[model samples]
Target chain A: MTTDSLKYLWQFALLCLLQVLIFNHLNLGGYVNPFPYIYLILILPISIGRIQLLLVGFLLGLTVDVFSDTGGLHAAATTLMAFYRPLYLKAQSPREGYESAAVPHIKTFGFAWFLPYAALMVIIHHTALFYLEVFRFSEFFHTLLKTLLSSTLTLAFIFLAEYLFVSTRRRR
Target chain B: MRNVLLFIYRNHVFFVFLLLEFVCFWLIVRNNNFHRGSVLSSSNRLVGNVYELNNNVTEYFRLKTVNEELALENAALRSLLNESKYISSGRKGEVKDSVARQHYTYIPAKVVNNSTDRRNNYLTINRGILQGVEPEMAVLSSEGIVGIVKDVSKNYASVISVLHQNSSISAKLKDSGYIGSLVWDGRDPQVAQLMDIPNHVELAEGMLIQTSGFSSMFPAGINIGKVKEFHVDEGDNFHSIDVELLTNMSTVSMVYVVDNLMRMEQIELEEQAQTDDD
Candidate 1:
């Protein structure tokens, strides 16, 4: 296997472990369930094949769903997010376009670009997740509040992780 | 055939995503008919084992509170025993003991997984089919009604907590014997709604609500909640009643699954009577 694939595999293992073990138990006043598993989908290399990306999203989500006992809500939402990642990238393509080998991260693309992309992904994922879990239009506002709060908290935690552990040289 | 193959080859990725989503949506939304589709649920062996391990460690931190609850239950049981013995009408103690034992069976279980925040909250207990816990059996804490057992596996069982939107329990006012049904509005864990009471039933705040014994799952006189506040909608003959549930659902660690010994016989007789009426 190539070094990039090896790196992603390790990242996948660590993120899933952290998500199920540490983040699932955080509670956060019972509303904000910060799903850092989305990070795995976000940081995939831009040129990776669609089939691999979709499969990874499904497995990652199903793993978290198993640990959290949420059934398949995570799997459904994460797979949808993976399907939309390419469109989101195309919508906000840089003037020079993306390098085929580049990974999407705050440092790699600068904070301005990374922030909106992550926000859109979080919004889509959380909207699908909260609505599907509740599955009622009567609680629309309540579900919306959960979606917004959880997305914000997830983005905050992702930012903190990126800033703390990532090396500057990797961005270049 | 060539055209179809060409289209399939071009759109395989999209179709694959669609197929995976269909499988996931089925898993998430469909209620399992035979319990085989949900190997990842908390009632399964692998997931249940992990939660049991986690609970084994965290249960230590709750020892003080748990002990207090157990002590209170012990006191209540002791008083009940004394009352039964004193009220025996010239019957021998052995016969009275047998009669008391036949009424209800309690299987004590520890909750290994619980969630109160969701729209449909469920509790996973360490007891299952091995312990004779069955679906539709009522569960109760020392304080009050917890929920009803929804599913049972080999070594674990899942309960549909009173906090669930779909949960409804038959209950009545203790003093006047006016009957109604209790249901959760999915808003607060502490409060639930008591419905189907006529406007003239005379419900007041703080009135005690208990199980009516009309259902075989729960016995009569089990404390459910107290009437908090109530209102009657315009042009409606029924009052909407709010109840403050007695059980602190968030902190419940130990629960007793109540298996009605004569439930099958009762159901059989009821069904027979229905056929005769027809």
Candidate 2:
């Protein structure tokens, strides 16, 4: 694999480790458990194949599940997040469209574009995660709180992580 | 064959997503099974180890509060044991022999992970199959009944909390002795809906509600909640009673798993009777 692919793989592992070890334990009053691992999916290069993206999402989620002991709740939710990521990207695209090799980061897309993009992905991921965790529609509104609160928190953390790690330099 | 291949190539991304989702759903369904031996759930060794490690570090902060609660419960239990009137009743032959035979044992567990915000909330406890905790056992806090054990691994177990939509506990009015089913409406965490009580039965606001012991999971007289509001519909025969649950589900740190000793025999006899009728 190229150094760039190797770097992405390392970043993926770091995200999973942070999630299971720290974020999984951060249960704030049993209401908020913000997942920052979606940042890994967010930062993936746009040039990656759709099939590869799905596989990567599955592997990323399964790794998180293996540590947290949540069975496959994360796996299913993250896979759905990956599936919709492309559609969401297309919908939020600029008038001229996105560069093929460009990674969607706060620095690259600006907060105006990246904020809504990350928020939507986080919301979708949380919705799927909470609903599947319950596995029933009877408590649609109750599960909505989990989706909303967690999405908000996850978005906050993702922004913080992006601001701290992602560089402002343009791709060569 | 060529057209089909083209179709597969064209919509391959969607197809891959569908297949991966299916696999994930299968994993979720398979792990939800209580009797599965090969499954690695939250209660399994690896996951248990991580939770335990975290608990060890975090538990120190809550030590004083947990100790105080435990001490209060201990005092209550001690007082109950020391009461001569209860023992005297047994000596006077007032208590039935069968009443003495019925035993409900409790296994104490620490709540490692709990959630009250979800539509269906599940609590993961430190105690599991290794500690004699099995699926279908009743879990409760010091104040009230919590939920039923849904799945158990070696060192951990997950409980289907009473706040869940699918959770229905057999409960009754303590003073009037009118039984009903207690369920959550997914709106308020502090409140649950107690339905199926006939309207004719008189129920004032703030009536005490407790377990009816109709089911094998929870024993009779376990405190569920108290009625906060009730209204009888003009056409319907049942009363819509909103109950304020005694257990603060959000903050519960410790719980007891209730194991009915005679559950197997009771289940077997019930199954046999049903088959005989068929």
Candidate 3:
């Protein structure tokens, strides 16, 4: 248990650093800024408590916010994503259901299962984040285009990260 | 009461989520307001230090362009010196007129962190309150105006960039002297809108736009941009003008923070006049 907590802490710190130092600086085509730090929440143990998940998401977002100078925008978006995570998982679970100690990873769940799950999560998070940052409905379509572009880039990066880190031989 | 408690306990996750969202919303609204010093911003010591460290690594790659920009600005400043130009005046002995009295002082600062793609972009500078930096001071790159200081910490300050949605600067046409409010339209980083110039005023493509100095934040005649295109609406009396900003906000790494020496006196007198009228 101590090792598990320590690993998560390290992951959290690394994600925040990667986001602030690297990803935040990427402004591809002046529209897409891939934010893949929310992958921290995505890879948490499926059975983690909801309240704990929410708090973790909020803290992760706040860490990014502190460095990016975007006050609370990420926090709100990540929290909303966390709130829907369990529902999405339950709705998409197989007939046999997930293992008690299962984690959400491409290697653990296979690419087919992980793709839609990660896409949904990334889309929700990006939509909420972009809209909140813009803070108006007047440019709804423009914001939507930006959100979609960023979400696609973020999804691609998340998958790249998953493939790079999660060993393929460790299938559950 | 027991039933109510059970219901609340059963839905504690939703309630907690709502509470956290509310807190975040409050923070966003507060941060959107100008001049509200908040610790969560990048100007905070921990974040500022991290950005400074990152900048230290990336700055080497940009040193060539930065050096050229500095050299160009130095030449411009050198030309402004009294000794640079041959004065035709035969009887000049250190004229101490009020016009010669310095009304602005500049503090050079390094841009540690900056962004341009975001709708409300901000630049974080290494100089802060320790270096006499304060909120509402004007920031300028060597080429043109950059932003206004929004918050200051001990060793860093965050500037609300001219590209921001809430940013508006009083600007004028250099030739016509028609003043307008310069604002970013949240689309293009290089282009900003100059609003409220009357339709009858003669305008031309590539006309120079400059600071009007109506506000205490900036001095008169600071080059902002040049007119890219302008047209009046079918029934409107004002011409909607597009200005191509002179400063490339994306690559601006060195800046100066302007401290208006007469700002306090001007504001105080204006307030007194208002009170008298009331």
Candidate 4:
């Protein structure tokens, strides 16, 4: 495989490890958790075929499940997310693509395009993950309260982490 | 054929989104029972690591609060020591001084993993089956009852937090002896509802609720929470009371898992009663 693809894949694996090894255990009170690492899947290079990118997301999430011993919970949620990555891309089509060598960011994608994109993706992932984990709606409203509130916090943390660590080197 | 192929490609993204959402939605709709698994859970190993890291950063933040609680407990213990002095020093011959001491032991444990953000949450402690802890043991902090031990491993055990939506405990008015199931509404950690307590029992907003000694999980008279708000359902005989939990679930750190020395006997008797009823 190409060096760039390999590098990104390595990055994805390491991030998944961090998520499973570190962040998965932090239950910071009720419905408050920091999960910025999922952004690795979100801001991956666009050069890879869309379908392949989706598969990789699925596999990445499944690997998290394996380490956490959560069986297929993360796997099923992530595979479905892999299927939807393109739509996230499409909704941000107003910008076409970031005109830089660096990956998309709030700085690159701009406030207008990036906010909706991040919010939508995080919601989708959180919804999938929470529902799969619970696998029930007996307390339908209670579960929904958790899914939405936790997802919002996760998305915000993703924003903060991206802003702090990602150094976008745009030569153009 | 070209038009059909192009149509599929054009809508591929939407189809993927639909499939993923549907799958996740299905998972939520299916799961019903709440069982035990502290190891592989929301505060799973990965989440545990984050909590450990966060614990470092916030450890300082909690030091003051923990110290205050510790001081309070120490004061309480010292007074108990004073009161029990008569019992010990009085029994000079037949009973040893140590034997006269109260054996209500408490083991300190760290919450390596805990989750309050989920619908049903649990906390994993560093001490477990090996540390004299066991399933059905009552877990508590200096504040009050944390939960019941659901599962245990060599060095770890998961506690079903009292905040959990499905969590049910026998509670009563500390004064009146009126009993009910303490149930969480899953909306707020500070608020839970006590059910099955008859309206005839007098209750005020600040009334203290404590474990009723009905279950082996929690010891009798352990402070639980206080009545926050209460209402009598029209035509119904029971009082639905909102209790404000005493423990700050947001920042639980150290806890004590209590093993009742006579829990087996209590549980066995209760089990036999159920069997007889059947």
Best by DockQ: 3
Query: Which digits, one per residue and each the tens of the lDDT, describe model 2 over residues A1-80?
Result: 39888998899978887886678657665567799998999888877778888999999988777555456788998999
Off by over 4 Å in 3: B92-99
Question: What TM-score, to 2 decimals, does candidate 1 have?
Answer: 0.89
- Candidate 2, residue B54: the lDDT equals 70
Question: Candidate 4 lDDT, tens digit per residue, A1-172?
Answer: 4887787778887787667546765665555554555677778764546667666776676566534434446657676666666666655554555443545577666767678777777777778777656656786765677678778877877778777866667422
The window of 10 residues in a row where model 3 chain B has the poorest summed lDDT is B92-101
**Model 1 DockQ class:** medium
Write model 1 residue lDDT over B120-227, tens digit each, in one string: 778889999998998889999888899988767899988888987678899999999988899987667788999999999887899999999988899999999899
TM-score of 3: 0.97
TM-score of each: 0.89, 0.84, 0.97, 0.73
Fnat for each predicted structure, in order: 0.49, 0.53, 0.70, 0.20
Best by lDDT: 3
Better by DockQ, candidate 4 or 1: 1
Model 2, runs deviating above 4 Å:
A1-35, A62-73, A87-101, A126-153, A169-172, B28-40, B83-99
Worst 10 residues of 2 chain B by lDDT: B84-93
At residue B87, what lDDT does model 1 achieve? 51
DockQ of each: 0.54, 0.47, 0.80, 0.22
User: For candidate 3, what TM-score does chain B get against the true chain B?
Assistant: 0.96
Once superposed on the true structure, which residue ranges of model 1 sit more than 4 Å away at CA?
A1-31, A95-97, B32-37, B83-101, B271-278
